[model samples]
Target chain A: MISSKWVVLVIYAMEDGPVRYGEFSRRIEGISKKMLTQTLRQLERDGLIERDIHPTVPPAVEYRLTALGESLLPFMRQLKTWAAANLPLVEAARTRFDAQSLAE
Target chain B: MISSKWVVLVIYAMEDGPVRYGEFSRRIEGISKKMLTQTLRQLERDGLIERDIHPTVPPAVEYRLTALGESLLPFMRQLKTWAAANLPLVEAARTRFDAQSLAE
Candidate 1:
């Protein structure tokens, strides 16, 4: 579940508060409807998120992170912070690697 | 590099100290030689690992984690610890979800 690239994206999208399905699609750019549905189901099944249905003319569905999921936020945030800070270094390394590879 | 499953395995294998290529092949089960080589190259290019070659009749080579890589250890370890502690909960949730899906 953690290995899925979409997992982190989806988790972060919901970091602020409960989110609707449509909102998730909009917030997480480049996610297909099928992938979003699948990711949400997987997260729910993993007990990381909870899906709630509100009674209305058309039942509204919202997803929020569970306590278990909330517990993961710090770790994910740390990784994200590290990535944000170090991405430039990675890009520079990639450029050098590609250049050397071409030279060889 | 972080998304690649083999990356973590290789990093952990080298966690204790420097490890030979052949030893990595042995320690990380089911990793193809090609995949291992590619992963190591990527890690080295990302500056997360250093490859050292020793002069010998049949030269010796070993891979070790770099400072940046060492910095990532705590975060990885925390995730590993969380996974170890919560895996059973996830498994239980999966079983429940599967059964519920079957019933539906």
Candidate 2:
């Protein structure tokens, strides 16, 4: 569970800088609030992300990648690049194959 | 849907030669038979895998990568390398954090 989404989410979220919960949720589309919280907690638990809280009246918390999380950025970037470049070809293949199947 | 799992499955399955459905399932460990069939169909549809049917007394079907699928191998290998190397640290971080949470 954590292995799947956290890798992508953590990399994506931390690419900018220290992000608040709302900011993190907004960046990764389709992740539910509950799942975003879960992923954040898991990442913090796993030492990939650090949660910082300010001592103030309201409350401020921000999340940033630890050394370990930063290490994974290259690999995640590679995956994202591959996905973006090849998606069209893959989609074309699907369309052709589906048409062939329907014909048969 | 297909993009997520199919990438990993096709890469893992095609590391060897043309694989049968059963062999592919066995190698992946946790994927259900239904999901395996679905993934294979998706890959075939996507033009990443080619299904070869042999003319024999019974029936023989094998799957191999098309030119596109072969192109993804290097990127997948990088991801696999990163995961295997970092899993231990990630697991250790989880343990330390969990212990800290319990103490607090």
Candidate 3:
């Protein structure tokens, strides 16, 4: 499986203490609802994320990282930094590619 | 786009100079033919990987990284090292999760 998606999901889910499904979906751009739900379920099943459902007139659910998920923060931070720094180059490559393909 | 897959594709394509489609496919495990073709097309469109077509009795195509693609090697290496080192922990978490779920 592509771990980068999981990494991004983990990072975004833990940005704040705990996040509701809608809040989590809004925070991470470009992720389909299906994918977000699938990822969350996988993470929960893996024990990296915990889902707590409140028992009330209206049920509310929240997700938070477990200790295991917390351990991935440093690595995620490193990846984020690397991606931010190098994104320009990748974008440039894309532009050059477009120009060349147009010429062809 | 998930750059990790691109990173892996670039690394595997450039592992030993230029690689043919079949050779590239064989090297990267778990990638479907459709995904591999899709990835290669995307990479080519982005100019990170160059595809060379040979005119022969049986047409042959090869892929190699451009200079931009080579620059990604360092980042890929870092990710590989991180994954290799941390994979055991992730596996352990999976086992723990499975056991706990079984118990529950």
Candidate 4:
């Protein structure tokens, strides 16, 4: 669950506060509506996010991170930083490993 | 890749340095051999781990975190800390959300 891209990005997108369903989908590019809905429901179930439903014409739905979810932000930011810093090294390692395999 | 349990634990198990294949399996409870193998291959492909094969009667296979993988440990530890601290809150949120769903 912690390793899920949709879960991570959904939580990331909502970190700034309430986000509508449409905006959420747009923020996480290449995500299907079905996948977006699934991730939202799962995140909500896990108590990481809150869904707000308004009594308007078509009904407004927005998501915000819960206190629990907010607590995870610093950690997420750290992971993001670590990944960014090591991406080049990781890529180089992959290239070396792949070439070694092809040679063997 | 980052979200895989086997990947996390496999990496976690090696935080202390190199570990044999058997030790890796034992360290992470409930992971199947097939899944473990797959995770190892994927992690190696991504340059997060290195697999050392030694010449022995049956050959020795040990896994160790790459420099890139080691760089991720601090971030991983932070994540573990956050998860521990917020677990109760997350669980409570889940309970409330579940009850609400049942009622709806």
Better candidate by lDDT, 3 or 4: 4
TM-score of chain B of 4: 0.89
Q: What is the interface RMSD of each candidate, in Å?
A: 1.9, 3.7, 3.6, 2.0
Model 3, chain B: what is the TM-score?
0.81
- Comparing 2 and 3 on lDDT, the stronger one: 2
The top-ranked prediction according to lDDT is 1
In model 2 chain B, the worst 10-residue window by lDDT is B1-10
- Model 1, position B64: C-alpha lDDT score: 98
Error of model 1, residue B96, in angstroms: 1.2
Per-residue CA lDDT of model 2 for A15-79, tens digit only, reads 86788777866778788888788878878887788999977657888899889888878767776
> Candidate 2, residues B1-104: lDDT per residue as tens digits?
23465458556778777987667767887888777788788778877789988887577888998888787777677767867888898889888998998999
For the predicted complex of model 1, DockQ is: 0.61
Clashing pairs in 1: none
Docking quality tier of model 1 = medium
Model 3 lDDT per residue over B1-104, tens place:
44456447546568568888888667777878887887887777655688899997699998898876676666567657756766676677778778887998
* Candidate 2: clashing pairs of residues: none
Q: Write down the lDDT of every candidate, Cα atoms only.
A: 0.86, 0.76, 0.71, 0.82
The list of candidate 3 runs beyond 4 A from truth reads: A3-10, A30-32, A54-59, A85-104, B3-10, B13-16, B54-60, B86-104
User: Which candidate has the highest DockQ of all?
Assistant: 4
| Full candidate order by lDDT, most accurate first | 1, 4, 2, 3
Every model's TM-score = 0.86, 0.80, 0.69, 0.91
Q: What local lDDT does model 2 show for residue A18? A: 88
Chain B vs. true chain B: TM-score per candidate:
0.81, 0.76, 0.81, 0.89
